[model samples]
Target: METIQRTHVTDAPPLPSPWRDAHVAVVVPTYNEAGNIAELTRRIYDLEMPGIRLIVVDDDSPDGTGALADDLAGQVNESHPGRMVVLHREAKEGIGRAYVAGMKEALARGADFVVQMDGDLSHRPEYIPRMLGTIMAAQAGLVIGSRYVPGGSLSAQWGRHRRLLSRFAGIYVNAILKLPIRDVTGGFKMWRREVLEHIGLNTVRSDGYSFQVEMNHLCEHMGQSIVEIPIHFEERRADSSKISLAVQVESMLTPFALRFGRRRRG
Candidate 1:
């Protein structure tokens, strides 16, 4: 694994990522997350962590997330050009495409590590350092923020139906795919740059939530170490949930096909 050492040199304007010289980029894929973009950007900027790059990819969200992202990028780049990038696609692509696009950007921008997570505040920014530690300590290719792990917990507000669905999905997918980790379907994860290259991300066909499962499977297949750390999973508080009935259907069906297809091939 290739690594870079970077230093944070200034405290004034010119927010250049002197530290971002390290292998790091945080990718936040958004679709109509206008309410959350400003605070998210602020939190990311205020965070003094080294080697962290913030890349926002928006799919032409009608709520103006793309414009907000551009504006935020402008504010940050006043001192640090290219520190932040906003990729705008014509329409809403699936989560898989958004992440794959972000991964490509991370690599092109010379990031050694890449992260995928929701923009809805469900994933706390404070957890980034901890996940980074897991990645480094375990020398794992991927570190997952898992809700099903021993120390993990889920919010109590979700209704029984939603809870049941997620539970069933996790159990079913893990069983079929025979994944070693507990949270095979979680989106909050950090991926080593090499794992993404080895996984052949181009081959992942899932367009919905199941994208996580396929990515995890690919990493495990490549003989990369994976760690699942306990995390508190919370439901999004703002903007409507994007997990529509169609998305749910795809989530269930996609895993079945991927798991079985791989079995046959193996």
Candidate 2:
């Protein structure tokens, strides 16, 4: 394990630069990612994204992901001067909760833009540049590194059934809540701090991975611009996916609730 520095950031930094100062922190919420965390963090830290930073949120992964995250942070602090933070939790909560925790940690540490993705590398790090590019060019509140967009494509490992389910979820959300982007469910999203601050993150309802859909819905409800960029989606090679049959059922049922529920849009 790498030796992660434990110093806390006490003040928020100024946010005025291209794509929110590229001071962006890619938040990887992990469960049992010990096998993948080190290499993944090393690759991203070496990618030369200028102000790009990373924060690994581990829900006290039993397989030692939390310890690995601390190690990664320490190595980053020693070798690189940019920034890396790790937030560890005591139990394995859902991804949605993990993300909320990460967002708060990032904001507390002065992150201007917070990017979210899977730690097993299913969402390619190479697309980080393109996503950030779109955000800067359009000043969009949310930029999705999408696989359903014009130039995006998915890997062949996913079966037709999986594809159909994903597409159906997109259509359902788009038609019901009427979000503006094609890949409303894509997790490889970048968000400007202003968007989170404005959306009232504390009030988000979705607790599963479907939280991605709810976030897009919130963005649309608030009339924030969303941009989609196509990219190849890679399959994970290490740990098994945390997605479950329960999540699939939730994804199918969430749009309907958001559409007709007594609450306002999002």
Candidate 3:
């Protein structure tokens, strides 16, 4: 494992309370996760962590995932009250764009910390408390639920070829970008609001799998403290994998584009 140098955000805005009093925003980007949306939100709300809010950014799925998300939000907020929100985008843009919109909304609503996770059950809600704990304990700028980290494991259902490809992708990206983080392409992550501010979300252009790489690259380029915790990544509870050949090609080509960018120092 490469050692990532940690740095602090100077003149940073006030951060939320570690676990209590902090306004935590969870951004769930959905495409066609209709089958899993209800359960996903229910589990998140069941955590019953005070100051927890869920923002479901739906990209207008033809399968009515957006409508289902709205229904779930309404049902959950009835008891929890203002704890869940749904942002319905006009059309499918990309996961990266949805996240940018959701994060911006969270910030606008005065969220102290923002988390990004898949709407599918693959990114378990059970590990959220642990992720928050890791960020606070390490005082990290970002905390990633990493599959490539020590103690992390992938789903047994994955075939050898899929596993090999994932490992190879990680190794290839690491060599090109030289990021100290183990799972650079992993989607499950939490960010301190200041890190997003420092990295300039508007500058991120990746629209697919490479989005994770772009965000990780920005964090490394800015010398932000990133902590990766072991997460057992399981297969999606519903829906097939969305990784297309175009996405794979984009992932393969992104590192070279980022290799020459100047690191932002403040």
The per-model lDDT (C-alpha) reads 0.79, 0.79, 0.82
Tens digits of per-residue lDDT, candidate 3, 1-266, equal: 11112233232233345564468899999988888887787667655367889999999888899888877777767777878889999987778889999998888888878999998898887677777777877989999999988899999988999889888889999999889988888999999999988787777877787889999988877888999998899888878877788777888888987897553333
lDDT of 1 by residue, 2-101 (tens): 1122333243222234433356788999998988887776666555565678899899999888988888888777777888899999978788889888
Report lDDT (Cα) of residue 242, candidate 2: 83
- Backbone clashes in model 2: 3
RMSD from true fold, candidate 2: 5.8
Model 2, span 30-132: residue lDDT tens: 9898888876776675554668788888888888988877867777777665488888888876888889888878877778888999998788776676677
lDDT of 1 at 62: 93
Rank all candidate structures by their TM-score, best first, as comma-separated numbers: 3, 1, 2
lDDT of 3 at 253: 84
Q: Give the TM-score of candidate 1.
A: 0.88
What is the lDDT, from 0 to 100, of the residue 151 in candidate 1?
Answer: 96
List of clashing residue pairs for candidate 2: 2-71, 3-74, 4-74
